[model samples]
Target: MKNIRNFCIIAHIDHGKSTLADRLLEYTKTIKITEGQMLDDMDLERERGITIKSHAIQMEYTYNGEKYILNLIDTPGHVDFSYEVSRSIAACEGALLVVDASQGVQAQTISNLYMALEHDLEIIPVMNKCDMDSAMPDEVEDEIIDLLGCKREDIIRASGKTGMGVEDILKAVVERIPCPTGDENAPLQALIFDSVFNSFRGIIAYFKVENGVIRTGDHVKFFNTGKEYDADEVGVLKMDMVPRKELRTGDVGYIISGIKSSREVKVGDTITHVDRPCAEAIAGFEEVKPMVFAGLYPIEADDYENLRASLEKLQLNDASLTFQPESSLALGFGFRCGFLGLLHMEIIQERLDREFDMSVITTVPNVSYMVYDKQGGVQEVHNPGGMPDPTLIDRIEEPYIDASIITTTDYIGPIMTLCLGKRGELVRQDYISGNRVELHYKMPLGEIVIDFYDKLKSISKGYASFDYHQAGFRPSKLVKLDILLNGESVDALSTLTHFDNAYDLGRKMCEKLKELIPRQQFEIAIQAAIGSKIIARETIKAVRKDVTAKCYGGDVSRKRKLLEKQKRGKKRMKQIGTVEVPQKAFLAVLKLD
Candidate 1:
């Protein structure tokens, strides 16, 4: 226990967290071969060039003739996956705060630093990417000192790409970071930081043994769910799962107990021996609050149950994902899943298809709203179709967020314009170190639901680092905008938006829908409406068949007769023809410029 060091890497996205992990693993001879971002083994993570999940691996290193067991959990740097970072932090005694030497002290960097401090985790600041020519080590060192209040020598100047200062980092972990402190003889108490489902082995839960010891074939139960299972296999995580006879206190390892049902295993749940359970559950683990809500409907209505099971298994892997059963008039049966942001939503949709074989349609994302009826009762609504009628709704309050953006001084004007265009109010600005400024804003969550982050990145030329936390809902002039096809409302495309931008948004949605929805045999009128009032409209002209092509040089009466016949046929078709809203049309709301 005294030789074990548990630590995690936390930083902004693309700050070389994975790269640094690669260097450490190689230096310790954990793996004979090396690959870029080897910790990010998922195909999606590789293709997207981002870490979507936290990966845990054990490495043995000899320092001053003393071998140490270093349990490292490399975490995703994106804000959407911050929950993963938080869970990783809870299971460790130390954290390596990786900040890019070129791009010093971004928003997520500060946010992750605060999270580590809140958990009382010892922080070892590592200034990564020092090999790059554009790297400003001195300036970034100052920024880290300002944020972490650490001395100059405390910061390790490392280059994940070139393996520079990699030795110092490991040395710091041994000398500075505290060893895990828990009673090995006490009742078994472990915190499950993460879990993954295996078809052959059932659910595999990775946990840190805080107290006591867990041995193979021991009966253990989860404190939260109260389900007991025999530890079929106990092991520590290396490049692969290395089976062990027992795992001691302050050790991080995986437990497989033949738990088939995903609901039986909960991430962040406490594990203890059934015979000698702890006095109470471990504290400091908080439930995640999803910021964005969207409906995910299976393409085939019959796949609803299968989709549910898939989501259950997926949820075991991703604890932050929340969903409940819901049905829509337009999209049939589905689940309204809550996510952290747009990128998180997209990743889940992709996973459903790639990992679970479930093809789904996602509704336009929105934030939950508080609808206060005339009777003074407040009801929360996540979907536009679930909203109460305007007559009964006395007022609506939408969720707001306190957003912090770290960018160079050059892009401040454009970033402000982008935020203000979305009705964001500037809170304050501070120059933490040099020309890099952190801008704070109070903005409606709905405004940034779709393309706000993408726009911020583009406007700042990828220099901006943005992170946000929810501020409680506030009263706003919001209205539900409904899209109608031939006067029939499509609930899947409905959205709740601020009243001031409703007209322009409605107009853009209509125009975009016209471009996406295919022209039927009869003319289709696409209209955007708000409570019986149409604010914007577009017409998809019918694919007309030229009935007069064969009437060349014919009498005027004959041509008129043919035209009249075609017109009557068209009229009949209009009455009976049903428009098929293509899948892209449902996604048009997200692309409205």
Candidate 2:
């Protein structure tokens, strides 16, 4: 226990967290240098050049002739996976706070720093990519000291690419971070931070042994679910899985209990020995709740079963992902899936396409709204199709977010304008450095759920970063903006918007749809309406045909007869024809300028 140091690396996206982890693995000889960054084994992660999940590995290092067992938990940097980072932090005693020398402190960096502080972890501020010509180590150091209140000499500067200060980082972990505290002789208790399903071994749970020892053949029971299983194997994670006889206190490893279903072992669940259970379950364990909801439908109706099977397989490793069978009048059968954020939703869609070879369509994302009826009953509506009648709903409340944006001073005016346009309330603004500022706002989650991030990036010329968390629900005058094609409402195109901007937003959406939908034989009326009142309208005229030229020097009566027949056919078609709305029209609302 005295020679063990458990820590994780946290940083913003594009920072060198994974690269630094690779260097540490090579310096300790945990894996061959030629093997590269083996921790990020997923193909999606490699393809995107980002970490989507937290990974753990065990390493042995010798410092001053003392052997230390170092457990390194490498966490993702995206704001979408902040929950994963928090769980990783909970399983460690210290954190290596990595910051890019060129980018300095970003929105996600500040969010992650506060999370580490909340866990009371010892943070070793490390400045990475210091060898670049554009590196501003001095300015970044000042920023770190100002934010963390650390000593000037305590910060470690390193370059993951050249491995300039990798050895010193390892040494700092040994001397500065405290070892985990637990009694091996006490009742067996472990915290499950993550889990993955294997076809051969069944459910494999990655956990941290908080107290006592767990070995093969021990009966373990989950504290929350009250389900028991016999441990089939116990092991530590090197570059690969290495089976061990047992796992003891202060150790991070995986356990296989012959459990076949991934749903049986949930992340954040406590495990204890069946015969000698712990007196109380571990605190701070809560199930992950999704923030964004969207409908995912297979492009072809015959592929619905294929999409269902793919989702079930993907959910084995992602405990936060939730879905259920839902059908739409316009979209047919599909699943209404819930995700942590937009990135989470996009990653899942990409995985479904890449892994399962399935093509799917996604609807506009929405947030859960609380609807209070005239009878004083409150109901939560996850889908707009499930909303009660407008007259039945006395008042509606929508989810709000506490948003933080970090950007240069030059883009402040445009950023503020963008936020205010989205119904954002300015809470506060602070200057973190000479040119960088942090703007805080309380905005509706629905506003940011669409194209708010894209607009922010555009206005700031891709220099701004954003992070947000749910701030509960608030009363708002929101109305449903319904889109109509040829006098028929398209349910999939309906969205909730603030009452003040409904008319203008409706106008833009109608105009955008006009550009996306193809012209038909009859005039197509694209309209946006709130209740029975039409707020905006656009018309696509029918394409004209050269009936007279086709006559070819015929008599005037012949030309008139052909034209009369064409006109009659068009009028008849208008009475019986249905306009086929293109998929692009459904998504055009997101591109509204």
Model 1, span 1-593: residue lDDT tens: 89999999999999999989999999999986555788999899999889998999999999999999999999999989999999999999999999999888889998998999999999999999999999999999988888888999999999998999999999999998999999999999999999999989899999999999999999999999999989999999999999999999999999988899988888889999899899999899999999999999999999999999999988999999999999998889999999989999999989998998898998999999999999989999999999987889899999999999999999999999999999999999998777888999999999998999999999999999999999998999999999899999999998998889999989999999898888888889999999999999999998988888888795899889988998899899988888877888767678777
> Positional deviation of 444 in candidate 2, in angstroms?
1.5
Judged by TM-score, which candidate is best? 1
State, as a TM-score between 0 and 1, how close model 1 is to the true structure: 0.98
- Candidate 2's displacement at residue 342, Å, is 1.6
What lDDT score belongs to each candidate, Candidate 1 first?
Answer: 0.92, 0.89
TM-score of each: 0.98, 0.94
For model 1, what is the alpha-carbon lDDT of residue 364?
91
Q: What are the runs in model 1 whose C-alpha is more than 4 Å off?
A: 552-554
Give all candidate RMSDs, comma-separated: 1.1, 2.3
* Error of model 2, residue 554, in angstroms: 5.5
Cα-lDDT of candidate 1? 0.92
